[model samples]
Target: MPNPSSTSSPYPLPEEIRNLLADVETFVADTLRGENLSKKAKEKRESLIKKIKDVKSIYLQDFQDKGDTEDGEEYDDPFAGPPDTVSLASERYDKDDEAHSEGNQFPPIAAQDLPFVLKAGYLEKRRKDHSFLGFEWQKRWCALSKTVFYYYGSDKDKQQKGEFSIDGYNVRMNNTLRKDGKKDCCFEISAPDKRIYQFTAASPKDAEEWVQQLNFVLQDMGSDVIPEDDDERGELYDDVDHPLPTSSPPASSQPIDDEIYEELPEEEEDNVPAQVEEQRKMNQD
Candidate 1:
């Protein structure tokens, strides 16, 4: 370490260097005064200011070269160093290639490809109000049904001429009907091309099987009847239970009555003035 008293100048820095030092000091002071500075940033700024001051002090002192040598050559600076340009370029190139490859890849399949459908067996049970599987079973059925619909129903030939039908007997309680008589449940089938087919089934499973067989026959005949939208197909099953709306009823023009006015007597000009004058007098008093 060099002795501080050995220096001729009382100040560590010369006049010009002192001015530069003063500017740096003022800048550091103002930055430290900033309220928004984070603790880490304040510490970093303080460290940097100290380093700058140390470098300035060394430059101002003009101390004789210590001539610290490494194999007869002066020591080279470590901090003021050049980066490895070649390595940086290689990394950048790799990132660009990865981005290009990702951009060219195919898009993922849409979630709408999966549709809901009731299992044929489940539908049979539901029709008769029989004990059936729970919600998890229904969900599993939907997944399997979607797979089957996509695999068999989506075929162009099957979709064009295939048909779906359901049949199950439902008992109706009517005040006018005889207690012993049961209503017949008719089977109705609609082909993709708007053709209708009818059949009778003793049970729900039988009805579903009949429809499946019909679908197979249509596929064998090169008829197409697959649904275009999976979501739309799911909606079809839901809407089957609900009655469709007919045309809306026409609007009616009706006059509304004024209840407050109805209680008042027929207006007379003198009576109105007297009432108003009496109310005004009461308020003033």
Candidate 2:
């Protein structure tokens, strides 16, 4: 049986694809915000994300179908650096912090505290620093603990390469599946300062469970941190109230029922009187 927690996106979204989707979203939002574009005109034009759903769908399916058998069950990246030591000296992300590359300054919780790990798996992540010429997706081991989430190069070394305080963070799933995702398993994380990061899961079901755990942590902590939207979700996908359109199911080919439109026949006056006389005689009897 397939692992219940495994998601459809064994591979992460490519850099080019992520950038394209982000650009389309930016264009549509900018157009809507500008005084130049009328409501009628916006409605008339094709939706930005809807136009590319098919492309993303095809790419995602094709990628998954490729015959490659590397069991992800064994994800052990050799942990580099010294003994685990996390410092929460700064509330905001410190770009200069040599210990944390992602700039999140949350102090690392004891590994033992993560007794109830919501998820543990291998996923390819877009590098914090990327190159255009090369499709730069870095591989890392990801896990969600009770209070925090951690990603690093290895399970043995236990060096927390990157970490996120799940509580109070705004998480959003993609509107459509891409070559690396299914049922919108892709998602992006936004920090309070508006920095965004994207990740893809192995399948749609896995994504839902993951998001639920993230929200649960926030509630458990009673955190008041309000996530800032990045000039409108610039990390390829997230929550937009008038949300990006998702890929809907195909319409059925069956014809409409004719009985619904058919009219009832009128009652004849002669038959109606006879029926009334019979009813009166029966009542008298």
* Clashes found in each candidate (C-alpha, N, C closer than 3 A): 12, 9
* Least well predicted 10-residue stretch by lDDT in candidate 1: 134-143
What lDDT would each prediction earn against the true structure? Answer: 0.34, 0.49
- Model 1, position 60, has a per-residue lDDT of 36
Give the alpha carbon lDDT tens digit for every residue of 9-90 in model 1. Answer: 4444353544344344434543244346788988987786666545544443332221211112211111232211111222
Please list the residue runs of candidate 2 whose C-alpha ends up more than 4 Å from where it truly belongs after superposition. Answer: 1-115, 133-135, 175-183, 223-285
TM-score attained by model 1: 0.16
Model 2 TM-score relative to the real fold: 0.38
Using lDDT as the measure, the top candidate is 2
TM, every model: 0.16, 0.38
Q: What lDDT score goes with residue 44 in model 2?
A: 45
Range of the 10 consecutive residues with the lowest summed lDDT in candidate 2: 84-93
Give one digit per residue, the lDDT tens place, for model 2 in 1-285: 233234234466574564454344333432233335676767644454344343344344432332122212223211232110011101011123323454546665444344678777765444454433222333456788766677654454335557766655777776442443233767666678744656667676766676666766666577476544566556545454357688765544222333333322233545788999999999999
Every model: Cα RMSD to truth: 34.7, 25.3
After aligning candidate 2 to the native by TM-score, how far in Å is the CA of 149 from where it should be?
1.4
